[model samples]
Target: MKRALLILAATAVVSAPALADEALAKAKNCMACHSVDKKLVGPAYKDIAKKYAGDAKAADMLATKIQKGGSGVWGAIPMPANPQVNDAEAKKLAAWVLSLK
Candidate 1:
């Protein structure tokens, strides 16, 4: 019983950050255009992770894109720049998106 309880606690601890990051995404309105597995206005987070999977600079590039926005990569529908998301918040969001992989 104690071992089961310990496992539950460990799972919670691991899941908490992921939940928090998702919450952050929602708060930033990222969820309006993006989802975990399904494509919305933007590509799915998991797809982004898969596309950038072995990339050493994905996090940084994604962070920059998060803040500055980019186009022609995903499609013709250019992603407008997010002036609301600061640099640090952009980095965190990018990291979380990449973690979906």
Candidate 2:
């Protein structure tokens, strides 16, 4: 019982930021084209994390891509520029996506 309680508490602590970032993503309309574990219009967050694993610059690159949008990386559909998401929110979303690995 004691161990279970501690584990649950730890899980909750770790989940809070993830949940918050997910909410942020949804609020920014990211979820319309992206999902965490599976491909949608865009690649899954997990896949992105896998591809960029061990990349020290992945977070910064992803943040810029999130705000300014990019094409050819994920193919022809293209991610539209997210003018509404500021740098901090974009960075937070990038960190969250990378953390899915």
Candidate 3:
């Protein structure tokens, strides 16, 4: 039973991309402006995911936007550039955002 529980825990960890990415987002201060389900200073992440649901290039575009920042896309409030997050982290964040239900 203990071995089975351990395997289940490992499986959960392996499958929980959103959980891991939420931690990354929090660490990178994304939660300051964006939330998974509701709008904050910025649009909700699930909304972003819904908007880009079918776009194949969304990941790359969003990653670039995260690093460089943009305005007039979602609203009048501009998204500030995140120089603290590297390219890889931006990509991961984009992927995670896009994965939201």
Candidate 4:
């Protein structure tokens, strides 16, 4: 029973990030505009990774940009401001977005 409990704890720890990302996505209302593979109002995650490839600062830059909201880079369709997204969540989303490459 103790070993089973340990395993459950480990699994919870490992799954936390995925849950956080899912929650963050929902909280940020990402589904209304962007997707991991296909273009919506904004470019796809794959396209973002492709554009910012090789840049070490992509996470930082993207996190800030996502929080503040911007446009012209991904076309005239302005990305809506996401003040609801915290810095940690933004960073995770940015990393996940870049990872979609």
Best by the lDDT measure:
2
lDDT of 2: 0.97
Alpha-carbon lDDT of model 3: 0.96
Local accuracy of candidate 1 as per-residue lDDT tens digits, 1-101:
99999999999999998899899889989899999999999999999999998899999999999889899999988888888999888999989888886
Cα TM-score per model: 0.95, 0.95, 0.87, 0.76
- lDDT per residue, candidate 2, 1-101, as tens digits? 99999999999999999999999999999999999999999999999999999999999999999999999998789999999999999999999999996
Ten-residue segment with the worst summed lDDT in candidate 1? Answer: 92-101
Answer with 3 or 4, whichever has the higher TM-score: 3
Candidates 2 and 3 compared: the better one by lDDT is 2
TM accuracy, model 4: 0.76
Cα displacement (Å) at residue 52, model 4: 1.1
Error of 3 at 24 (Å): 0.6
| Collision count for each candidate, in order | 0, 0, 0, 0
Backbone clashes in model 4, listed as residue pairs: none
Question: Worst 10-residue stretch by lDDT in candidate 2?
Answer: 69-78
Give candidate 3's total backbone clashes.
Answer: 0
Q: Rank order by lDDT, top first?
A: 2, 3, 1, 4
Predictions in order: lDDT = 0.92, 0.97, 0.96, 0.84
**Per-residue lDDT of 1-101 in model 4, one digit per residue for the tens?**
99999999999998787667756776779867887779988888789989998899999999998899988898888887899988888898988778664
Output candidate 2 Cα RMSD. 0.9
TM-score of the candidate numbered 3?
0.87
RMSD of each: 0.9, 0.9, 2.3, 3.9
